[model samples]
Target: MSTDTDRPLWLSGHMAPVPDEIDAVGLEVTGTLPDELTGRYFRNGPNPLPGNDSGHWFTGHGMIHGVRLNGGRAEWYRNRWVRTKKLADNSPFLRDDLTFDRAAVHANTHVIPHAGKILALVEVGFPYEMTPELETVGPCDFGGRLTTGMTAHPKQDPVTGELLFFGYGFMGPYLTYHRLSADGELVESRDIDVPGPTMMHDFAITENHVVWMDLPVVFDLELVNGSMPFRWDDGYGARLGVMPRHGDGPVRWFDIDPCYVFHVGNAHEDEQGRVVLDGARYSPAAFTAIWSETGGPVSEVPAADAKDPATAAASTGSARLHRWTLDPATGKATEEALDDRGVEFPTHDDTRTGHRHRYLYTEADGGAIVKYDLRTGSSTALELGADMAPGEAVFVPAEGARAEDEGWLMTIVSDRAGKGSELLVVNAADLSRTASVRLPRRVPAGFHGSWIPDA
Candidate 1:
């Protein structure tokens, strides 16, 4: 119910949206930019317009902040608002029948370059097309072949070069799977069977199968007050589904104890044909606490006991890297905790998207970047010192990379003292800072981004 003037820290201060778009040329650089890094790094997130109210951090109008790099130089920087129909009309997206108007996309979650086009994506609406220069080009429905929304976390198969994605809605046929050809055409679309409308944010693609997370978060139309309509539904249950990548069969769902997964690191099929899925896991209690902090009202649930250890831990949305192993032959799935730290935004080498990866990158709750070695179970962290916070770290492979993790990890860092923002590039192998490009102003910490190479 609070306005932008008095919104939570996530929606105000340096995290707040800039009133107007700006462009600057020849950004200053503190160190030599990698010669191999010749592309634009763009990150998208909610940046509600002035005096506008979305009531939730996740639902604000989409804005993109980007930096262009070329020939070992920080070329330029720009920011632009994604001009969507709902945003232009200054109206809410939900209609009387609960169906979204086709162009209601906020386009704020993730930005990626695919099939010679840069796509800004939100889960509930069509992907918004943006130029390499950061100007909105309107909604892209793949030549009218795509009828459903597109997930921001689409996976491009490293081997097949096909883009694999899904969409989830509050209405029937709640989930759907889609595949795009390497040349960027909508090739396959199928309705995925699920029990109900649950919040399916992200999924995983193994070499041979597609992994689905049907968690407890469900939509509540009556709870809408200009914020996210989803709340924790304990009765909805939790499960994981595995389906063949190219086959037509029922998605085999395996029941799991109630838990929520937002982002998946990577997945693959083991030698035994068991699907291995890994990501950050949040307990039900933790989920409630985090959602509550978004400054949005949630449906009432019984309070937890103060003296209980598990209950206290759930009061904070502290997620730990967790692993799930699904044995197809036995139709069973088992999960275990990989680490006990509070982490989010887990990522790995994109080239290994559908294959087993050894290293995982995550943003620690304490404002540090951590790399976890899955094979040795060892961990390392890179601290940006005090008064500095970094957003998601995306891995960019070196030119003709030798190993999976031998490239560079890049992220936009915000200086807490209002000093300004800079792009920090770290060596993925040893977690060393390699380059820092100083921008004209502080770029707020936001959601997912990708490194699109010029070559």
Candidate 2:
């Protein structure tokens, strides 16, 4: 057995991988689970097999933990590994001829319900289809209409129910935007022009446009053998692009300060016709520190310049909520920091995904679920205490809700000692615990998830 000191940070403590799949029923609940909150919560993340390490936290095989709730009770909880080609026989993602086998990737980043199917997603591979029970049905290519890898962070338009997403590769034609109709038909695909290939993890969409983050992290061939081949390249520069949602007009690119954004909160068009975007922004030094700890390549930037005091002091990575306002009239972009607290996994009401919104929800690095009210320029947080670490706070709107934040925030809070886990349901309006279902085992900290309601 490997000693704790010998293991990578991703393989130790709360980030540790579970041994195998298991299930439990009639879980213990601390408080009443709202009757209207009936749904299945599924979360996806990297979980390397026992005695196996994928070299990096982001490259491990995909595993999903699911919980079922109905009639104000926790019904069942189970976990399963996504049966990808890479997971079945350890197939190589890159073939001998230097081409990618899209199915041979760890679809471990995010899980969302699109159309009539639940998809497990990763940026560099085809999405794996999962049944309502969390069984793998195989990879999907949208009836063979999707030719490139699908992003894990697709945005569903609340008004039209269309899914808008993009795919990026290290090769030419680096980025391509795609759209899926409300009924799940792959309707549109357009090639987006970008300078080069970068680790474009997430993007934003407004009422009439698509927002792209072309940051400085570029792919390097020399780092191909490493855990992640991308690194911070200050020379590449950082810019955000705004393109029409339905027109052939050229994208308006606005040069911005050097930074990185892994997740976007929301985007919308203001009354003055400006595109406003919100996300968790990471400084170069902060990104470098977190990247290095996650088994990524060390930045070429000097150690003196790459050491961030604020980031070094936090257990989770440091990223502050920020906003950018792009004016089409003057072709200029203005940036501002919304908060100084280190936070990630920003979420908002889906009804306001591509429209003006009043509230934003996020998980603070210091173990709290924070709510930001943009209208009042104030924020509130529900502290999870020292032993508990909260995952992404996914917002679920209450039925017939009039207020923007009249809903519940569902998240998985894992114990730092790796003892156990629980599904925490918090009232979005008051930030109070509505219920807590004790999980059967300690769930390793993972990526994004979704609340799939029964139709």
Query: Best TM-score goes to which candidate?
Result: 2
| Per-residue lDDT value at 24 in model 2 | 94
Measured against the true structure, the TM-scores of the candidates, in listed sequence, are 0.95, 0.97
Among the numbered candidates, top lDDT falls to 2
Q: Tens-digit lDDT track for model 2 on 1-455?
A: 76767889889878999999999999999999999878899999999999898788999899999999999999999999999999998888889999889999999999999888999999998999999888999999999998789999999999999999999998988999999999999999999999899999999999899999999889998989887999988779889999999978789999998889999999999999999999999887778778888888874542323465554445244889999999999999999999999999999999898999999999997789999999898999999987789999999999999999999999999988788899999999999999999999999999999999989
Worst window of 10 by summed lDDT in candidate 1:
299-308
Tens-place lDDT per residue, model 1, 97-198, is 876776786888999988899999999889998998888889999999988889989999998889999988778789999999999999999999888888
Q: Give the TM-score of candidate 2.
A: 0.97
Off by over 4 Å in 1: 1-6, 95-99, 299-309, 417-419
